[model samples]
Target: MTTLQVEGLTKVFGRGAGRTVAVQPMDLEIDTSTALGIVGESGSGKSTLARLLVGFETPTAGAIHLDGRPISRMLSMPRERREFRRAVQFVAQDTFSAFDPRRTLRDAVATPLRVLREVTGPAADAEIRDVLGLLQLDPALLDRYPSQVSGGQRQRFALARSLVVRPQILLCDEVVSALDVSVQGAVLNMIRDYCETYRVGLGFISHGLPATTFIADTLLVMRHGAVVETGPTEQVVDRPEHPYTRTLLDAYRRGPRRVVAVDPVA
Candidate 1:
């Protein structure tokens, strides 16, 4: 099985008395067939962790390993960097901002193929169609601009773009937080199914406990850039060992639940 490992991963900003630790030294391992959920309140370093995984930000300390091989050194070479990009993909929370407002869906989703040189011409077209279909996005919508679609559709398109790269691991940073409750469920299900089918390791970061429970097999709860609890989702959710985790669960239970109508995609 393919595995991604993080060892002593840490990130900090500023220096001296003004310094702030965004992500404390953390260790995690994710198998290709498994999903890991990270839940935390705002400024808890959830997004910072995701950025570190995807190489968006330089880590003050730590290393990322793919299948037991260190990837940080390989990332320095041109060819290896392209391969790294293909192996790891990211989906951001701001779907609208992820896409270029001026580009059509086809252009946005196909950019990875072109950049990665994975496929071209008719092959790329076919792959794009297949990925969009898997995401339950209408192929007709491919001709439309990002601004023309609903927020849910935009998020689905963002996922489709990520899928085109055929990544071994996918990092989703609050991808469903902006959607309606019903839309959120659909997107979550879609992500679960896609990861299972492709055996893609998933790192899902979210503030919503219920949503994390619905999607992740393992849970990592964080507070102030540190892990408060880590265990199987069921154990962590049902019998939280940490007060912070229990408080999170309690907050979710007290929140109002809203039901929204969702469309069935063939």
Candidate 2:
């Protein structure tokens, strides 16, 4: 089985008095068919961790391994880099901004296939259609530009774009935070189904505990760039050990149904 492992992963910025530790040394492992959620409030470094895993940012002090092979080494070589990209895909929160406003959804989805030289002509068209279909998006929308669709549709299209590449791991960073509550629930369901059907390992980064609990089998809670708790979702949510974890759970229980902020008092 494919496994993505991180050991002593860390990221720091600036120097001396100005230095800020964005992500402290942390370790994690994700295997195929499993979903791991990283949840925390703003400035907790959840997004930074996702960036490091997807190669958007290089690690300051650690190693990322895929099935025992170093990802850093894989990223250094042109051929291996392409392979790595195919193996791991990222879905960002700003779905509209992620796509070119001028391009049709089909064009946006087809870009990766063209860059990777993976498919062509009718085959590529078929692949794009198939993946978009999986997301329950209408085929007619394929001809529309990003600006022509609703935010929810645009986000689903973003997911379609990633799925078209047939990635083994899906790294999502606050993917549903921008949508309406109803739309968020729909999108979350679609993501869960897609991951299960494809047996893709999911690294879901979100500030929303409710959404994370809905989608992830395991939870990794963060606070100020450090892991405050890690365990099965139920245990962490229902029987939290860390004070921070309990605070988060309490907030979710007491706050508005859709929000996921931490409570001032636990």
Candidate 3:
């Protein structure tokens, strides 16, 4: 099933000739229970596309269909909007900042369920424990504040919170960028595992090609507010077609190269 379909999506800021096209008529689709990665350098509009998907920002032109229904066209009904919000959730690049400094992790994670009236008392506790366990987060740390936890812990907590709401699709915006390399892999793998287990669709937005290559089934490369290229993740990483895509791959290659070389005995 097609979880998301975006067509002719354009997001422009400013006016006239001075307008900045954040996203220009982009087209994309994501299947159910799968993962797609959108990679781009800074200012490439990857995050802008994510914001549009989750209804955080209004697009200048075009349409987004979530489960075959156009989200942009449902503004008339409050019930539909609430349903849309419940169907999709976002995990920001920085979890610590997205959370409250005074709130415990459990309280923060439970905020959504509390508002939605989905669980209470013992049910809420079970819900929290289930989500945290799914994310591989230790139960002992639920009482800690965001500031007291490591970056990886915070990221896992963010994922836990998102999952607690039972969202069908998750828009993850560089959720692992701030973590240590070793921790990054663990948290990312946890995300993949959860998505597989729950059949939740994921759209991962990041500049890290190597990391994206590990979990994504599809890769979409954006350059200057447009999709430069897209294909299977392995194919795009191994055989990039667009010049911009090549540049991204080259930039991510490991180790220093001999930029200028001469015969050693010369």
Candidate 1 root-mean-square deviation in Å: 2.0
lDDT of 1 by residue, 152-225 (tens): 89999999999999998999999988888878888888888899998999999999887888889999999999
* TM-scores, all models, native as reference: 0.94, 0.94, 0.91
**Clash totals, every prediction:** 0, 0, 0
In what order do the candidates fall by TM-score, top score first?
1, 2, 3
lDDT of 3 by residue, 45-66 (tens): 9999999988888989999988
> Model 2, which residues run further than 4 Å from truth?
255-266
Ranking by lDDT: 1, 2, 3
TM-score of 3: 0.91
| Model 2 residue 121 CA deviation in Å | 1.1
TM-score of 1: 0.94
RMSD of each: 2.0, 5.1, 7.5
Residue 255 error, candidate 2, Å: 4.4
